[model samples]
Target: MSTLKSRLDVVEQKISEAASNSGRSRDDITLVVVSKNNPAQMVLDLAEIGVSNFGENRDQEAKPKAAEVALAGKTVTWHFVGQLQSNKAKSALSYSSVLHSLDRPSLLDAVGKAVADRAEPLDVFIQLNLTDDQNRGGIQTQNVLGFAEQVLQTPNLRLLGLMGVAGLDVDPRVDFDRIRNSSEQLMRLAPDAKYISAGMSEDFEFAIASGATHVRIGTAITGKRPY
Candidate 1:
């Protein structure tokens, strides 16, 4: 087996074990291979081996990469998993089927305008800032519900759930638990918005155990960034 496939197999095994230990099935989780800083050929290779979901954080990088993948005739779900700028909203929405960082009112307004008249609602997750820093990429913990309400009211935007990153030097599960609680709160407002988009390479297992429906993993499966 190729080294990439070998690494992928190991991560899949760990995911299965984590899900089973948490009383959930492997199918219950969606493994979004975070391909930021990696090449499009890597995404095509993983897709050839059955990886159907890929994530990118930057529109500039993702647009050309996504076009290359499509030109090669490979079909895959694209997820935008980084803090998005307002000006890039339309471009990001062009290829990304799911947006994991719908954090601010201006972004919501931007997305709402971009997707106006589209046939499908743009799938989105309200990112929750797990740290005390006000300038972080995600929504403040206290403002999540209020922001979620705004998301629901917007046109052509589907409120998926909450996404968060654990603070530095803290046990990951602590933040995962907080994400779960925030998801629960979001669900009360939009019951179908029960999905939690948490976890990365370091703490995905903890996130899965704490009810993460989507795990954005990089390096473990994609290896180190070239840059």
Candidate 2:
């Protein structure tokens, strides 16, 4: 097997084990390869290795890279996982199959406008900031339900579900619980929004146990990224 393929095997094994331990089907979880700063060729390489879903955090990079992947004739789902500004929403709408960071009303407005103009319904996740830190970009827990309600009402947008990151200072298990709880609340508000996107290279197992349908993993398969 090629080196990248070998690494991918290990990661898949870990995911399977995590699912087994959690008593959930491995197929229930989707792996979203985070390709933020990675080159388009790397994404193509991953696609060649049977990876069909990838995520990027910056529109400037993600927009073109997504186009490149499409041009290369690879079938892949591109997720935008960043704090999207209003101005960049149009560019992001062009390529992202799912927008994973809808944190504010202005962003929602921009996305609604962009999608309406294109007449495409984009999948959107309301980011929840479980941490006490305000610096983090997410709808506060208290406001999330109302915000999610609003998002569901927005035109040309499908409320896919919730997304979050474990707080830097909190235990992964604890944060995973918080995220799962938030997801549960979101589901109560919007029953159709079933996706819970959380976890990364470190705490994906915890996330799976907490009912994450999607996990964003980096480094483990791609190796260390250059800063």
Candidate 3:
């Protein structure tokens, strides 16, 4: 098997094992292969093998890469998974069907305007700031509910629960549990918004155990980023 195919198989097996351990089915989780710095060809290759969801972090990269994949006639769901600049909302919205980093009011407003006339509502996750870092990209735990309320009110945006990154040195399940708690709280407001977007290359197993419905994994399956 090709290295990419081998790596993908291993990740899928691990995901299946994680889901089984969590008392959930493998189908319950959506694996978003983060194609941030990876090339479009890699995405196309994966798509050909039934990987329908791919994630990109930068508008500059995603724009051209998405275009390339589209031009090649491959159909894939694009997820924008990085901190977004308000001014780039239009650009990002143009290609992504899902935005995994909807964190602030300014971004919400920008996205609202950008998708006002689109035929489909953009699926979004309210990013959570797990730490006390003021410079971090997500909304703090205390403010996530209010922000989620705002996202629910916005036109052309579908709230998809919470997205977070566990602190590098801490146990990942701690952060994953926090995300699940927040997701439960969000569901009290909008039940359909119960999907938790957490975990990555190193900690997806822990995330799955904590009820993460969507895991954004990259390097483990995509290989070392060329950049």
Candidate 4:
């Protein structure tokens, strides 16, 4: 078997075990393999192996890669998983079916305008800052619900719950628990918003146990990134 395929198998096995340990069905969790700096050919190879959900981080790199995959006739769900800017809202929305980093309310109108004429509404996650640091990309945890309500007010955007990066200096369990609680709080306002998109390749096991419906895994599945 190819090395990449083998790598994918290992990650899936880990996810399955994590789900089992959490007393949750593997079906309840969606593995969003991050393909940020990876080549489109690599993504196609993963598609051939039944990986339909892929996450990309940057607009400039992601747009062309998503186009390449589409041009090849492969059915892939592209997610934009980086910090978003209102200026690139339209272009970023053009290639992504989901944006995992909707931390600002200002981009709501931009995203709505971009998808206004489209047949489908865009799925967005209100990213939250889990650390005490203010330099991070997510909205403050306390402000997540307020921003989520704003997202709900937009006509063309669908609130898909919250996304966050665990603090580098903190414990995985703490961050995951906080995120799960945050999801519960968000649901009080937006009932349908139960999806928790926390965790990464390193802490995904803990994340799954904490009620993460979606996990963005990268190196564990795609091998080490070149960039």
Candidate 5:
């Protein structure tokens, strides 16, 4: 097997184990391989191994990479998962099928406008700030529900779910609980929005138990990314 195929098998094994331990089915969680700086060829290699979902952090990088993959006749689900500036919203909307980091109202407005103009119904996740760190890009926990409502009202933007990263200081389980609670709040407003995209390579098990339907994993599967 090729290196990408071997690595994919390991990742699949880990996800199965994590799901089994959590009393959830292996199919319940979708793994979104983060291909931030990785090349489009590597993404294509992973796709051959049955990885259809991938995520990227920057607009400039994601835009060209996504186009290249599409041009090569590969169908991959692209997720935008970074701090988005309003000016970059149009470019992000062009490439990403789902925007996973909608944290602020102004950013939401920008995305809404872009989606409306494009006439594409884009899936969006409300990023929640589960930690005390102000530098993290997400809406404060107290404002999640309100933000979900705002997201729901946006034209051509579908509020698909919530996303969060665990804080460094707290236990992974505790952080996951916070994310679960916030997800519950979002569900109250948008019943159709059912995804909770939390967890990484380190804490995906906890995140699965806490009800994460999607997990973004990188290094564990692709090996260390090129800096």
Candidate 6:
């Protein structure tokens, strides 16, 4: 087995243990292997290991990376998880099957315009900034419902759930609760949107206990991205 395969095995084992501790079935959680900044071969290595979902945080890098992965004849679900811009909407949407960074009215409008009349609507999550930094890519807590309503109004985009990352100084538990609470509020608005996406190598266990349906893991599973 490859060295990366060994790391992935360990990460999956840790996930199983976390699920057991949280009383949630391991199957209930989706592991989104984060491949941002990692080479395409590294990503294919993950695909070979049976990962169906991968997350990328940039448009320029992700677009070609995905194309290369496809050219190599491997298919995987790519998720756009970075701060999104209105200009890159089309290219970003092209590579991403699900997007975890839907945050503003303009972006909602841009995506609706970009994907309108496509065969499939894109799955999207409203990013809830667990920190005080507004520029950090999530809509503020007070604006989640309003933003979600915008998402619902936006054509060709399905509001899947909420996504968040803990702030540098914040506690993981608190950050995750805020994200889970956002999901609860969102469900009241749109019951079908029930996926809570959060956590990472450092705190996925806490996120699982707090009701995250999906966790984006990078270094722990793939090791550090080679610069």
- Candidate ranking under TM-score, highest first, comes to 1, 3, 4, 6, 2, 5
The lDDT ranking, best first, is: 1, 3, 4, 6, 2, 5
For all candidates in order, the CA lDDT equals: 0.92, 0.87, 0.91, 0.88, 0.86, 0.88
**Residue-level lDDT tens digits of model 4 in 1-227:** 28888888988998899999989898999999999878999899999999999998889999999999999999899999998788999999897999999877677778888889878899989898887778777888888877877789888788889998887888989988999999999999999998989889899998999999899999988878552
Clashing pairs in 5: none
Collision count for each candidate, in order? 0, 0, 0, 0, 0, 0
lDDT of 3 by residue, 1-227 (tens): 28888899999999999999999999999999998888888998888788999988889989999999999999899999999999999999998999999998999999999999989899999999999898899999889878888898999888878999999989998999998888888899899998989999999999999999899999998889552
Give stretches of model 6 more than 4 Å off: 225-227
TM-score of each: 0.98, 0.95, 0.98, 0.96, 0.94, 0.96
Maximum-lDDT candidate: 1
**Which has the higher lDDT value, candidate number 1 or candidate number 3?**
1
Judging by TM-score, tell me the better candidate of 2 and 3.
3
Residue-level lDDT of model 6, residues 77-183, one tens digit each, is: 99998889999998899878899998887888888988996789899988887776767778998889988887887778888899999776878999899888878
Instruction: Give the lowest summed-lDDT range of ten residues in model 1.
Output: 218-227
Question: For candidate 5, which ten residues in a row score worst on lDDT?
Answer: 218-227
Error (Å) of candidate 1 at residue 127 is 0.3
TM-score-best of 3 and 6: 3
Give lDDT tens digits, candidate 2, residues 84-143.
989998888788889999999888988888898655689888999887778779988889
After superposition, candidate 3 runs with Cα above 4 Å error:
225-227
Which window of 10 residues has the lowest lDDT sum in candidate 2?
218-227
What residue runs in model 5 are displaced by over 4 Å at the alpha carbon?
A: none
Q: What local lDDT score does residue 24 receive in model 6, on the 0 to 100 scale?
A: 82
lDDT of 5 by residue, 30-134 (tens): 899998878998888888778899999999898999999999999999988888999999988887888889999899989988888666689989998886777
